[model samples]
Target: MNVAASGTALKRLRRSARLIVLAPGPRVLMFRYDIPGRDPFWVTAGGECEPGESFEQAARRELFEETGITAEPGEQIARTTPEFVTPEGEPVRADERYFIVRVDSPDIDTSRQTDLEQAWMNEHRWFALDELDDWHEALYPETLRSLIEEHTA
Candidate 1:
């Protein structure tokens, strides 16, 4: 556990890798998480890195686990600075690295999601770049729209 300058105990740092999965429509795939006690929010497909795993390795593994899409996680494109609690109730300061993966098809397979994921992640969708701005739900990273626009430009 880390400590803040104010002498408060801070959430443990969790290293994570995320992917921006772009489909044929130049749309991005996102999962809607309905975590208990919190409003639903959309997020990319990714997860925490296992011990000794590189960000790239974790990104690939998470992509398969979350969407069943196997692809190379190319150059990192964005990152997030936030402190949030996981569904399991663990508070964490996430060091999240983002990468881009382009898929030929938008088909997703949730068969591989863990029990926790299945319970919280009830829906998935591919949104066009412009659709993100008008999206009613909150998007993690907050800067996702601008990030996508910057990269896809």
Candidate 2:
């Protein structure tokens, strides 16, 4: 086992950003990896804080690039981090901050997906808030889960 990384402190650069969608309704933008031999698992939309851009700007940029959806919601934002492992076995981490942006139109302009093997998500649907619990429990970070729970409660 690698012993040094365990004792090595993760000099966390707390990124102040946002997770775009929280509550369910019209359309919650999520992504799934189009692996060669497995079903897809949808995920929330978010990105890291840009050089000097605010979380909102990054969210909008990411949403458009990812789902081709342009959302302009009017709600307060939250910050947190979620854990993930890369397909290559390396660990991936992101300090995410999110806000609820109620979309203006129903038809999102998607097409930015470019990965030949990891692109082409089969489905995109708007689900109820209750539907989020399972995935959130499994995928979302503690801070994100707690924030969602408090809001739902």
TM-score (all chains, Cα) for each model: 0.93, 0.61
lDDT of 1 by residue, 1-153 (tens): 677899999788899998899987789999999987898999999999999999999999999999999889998888786888888899888999999899998789999999999999999999888888878999876788788778988
What lDDT, from 0 to 1, does candidate 2 have?
0.54
lDDT per residue (tens digit) for residues 2-118 in model 2: 335558534334354454463334334455554555444555655456688876677777676656766663454565555554334445455766676555555544577445423
TM-score, cand. 2 vs. native = 0.61
lDDT of each: 0.90, 0.54
After TM-score superposition, the amount by which residue 4's alpha carbon in candidate 1 deviates from its true location, in angstroms, is 6.0
Which portions of model 1 show Cα errors greater than 4 Å? Answer: 1-7
Using TM-score as the measure, the top candidate is 1
What TM-score would you give candidate 1 relative to the actual structure?
0.93
- The clash count for each model shown is 0, 7
Candidate 2 ranges with C-alpha deviation above 4 Å: 1-18, 22-27, 35-40, 50-52, 72-76, 87-89, 116-122, 134-153
